[model samples]
Target: MTRGNQREKAREKNLKKQQQNKKGNKNDGLSNLQRKEKDAEIMRQKQAAAAAKKK
Candidate 1:
């Protein structure tokens, strides 16, 4: 009986965590293409900075 209660509690905790993850995107509702473009731009900036540091 105690084991069953623990299992139920663990299941509920997992479900709550999943729900929080689903809501945690920080993209400001950008579409897929826009998000990709933004990420690419950031990567380019980082690469440029690294090259400058190496020089």
Candidate 2:
């Protein structure tokens, strides 16, 4: 009886962890795209500043 209880507790913990990991993976994928866009924006700003200095 105690063994069965332990197994049930372990299973519940693992299931919750799996759910959190899935959500984290989805969020990570979105953050990556945002990071790329931010980098590109920064590069464009630098180029604009350089061009203004040249003018």
Candidate 3:
């Protein structure tokens, strides 16, 4: 029906938007392992800062 067509169009629009947003991401080209390593390094730096503050 007409309602079903509208729902399908909306779903397609949302998928396109999501794909566009993904293209704009900062880690667009990085591999999963590299991302994890970068995140872990950031966490370590934050932990060291917190420890220094507590001392």
Candidate 4:
């Protein structure tokens, strides 16, 4: 009886974690393409700064 209770608790916890992960991913402000574009812009700025320093 105790073992069954533990298994039920574990199953509920696992379900909660899965739901949280699904909601967390959806809350991200940027879509995949926007994220990639922002990253590329940041990289370009860093490269420009390095080039300026070298000159």
What would the per-residue lDDT of candidate 4 be over residues 23-42, giving only the tens digit for each residue?
A: 87742699889988888999
The number of the candidate with the highest lDDT is 1
For residues 1-55, write the lDDT of model 2, one tens digit per residue. Answer: 9999999999999999999988875345557779788878999999999999999
Tens-digit lDDT track for model 1 on 1-55? Answer: 9999999999999999999998998788999999999999999999999999999
lDDT of 3 by residue, 8-48 (tens): 99999999999999888978689999999999999999999
Clashing pairs in model 1?
none
RMSD after CA superposition, every candidate: 1.4, 7.1, 2.7, 3.5
Off by over 4 Å in 2: 26-55
What global local distance difference test value does model 4 have?
A: 0.91
Regarding lDDT, does 1 or 3 come out ahead? 1
Q: Give each model's clash number.
A: 0, 0, 0, 0
After aligning candidate 3 to the native by TM-score, how far in Å is the CA of 46 from where it should be?
0.2
lDDT of each: 0.96, 0.88, 0.95, 0.91
The segments of candidate 1 whose C-alpha lies over 4 angstroms from its true place after superposition are none
Would you list the clashing residue pairs of candidate 4?
none
Per-residue lDDT, model 2, residue 13, is 100
Give the better candidate number (2 or 3) by lDDT.
Answer: 3
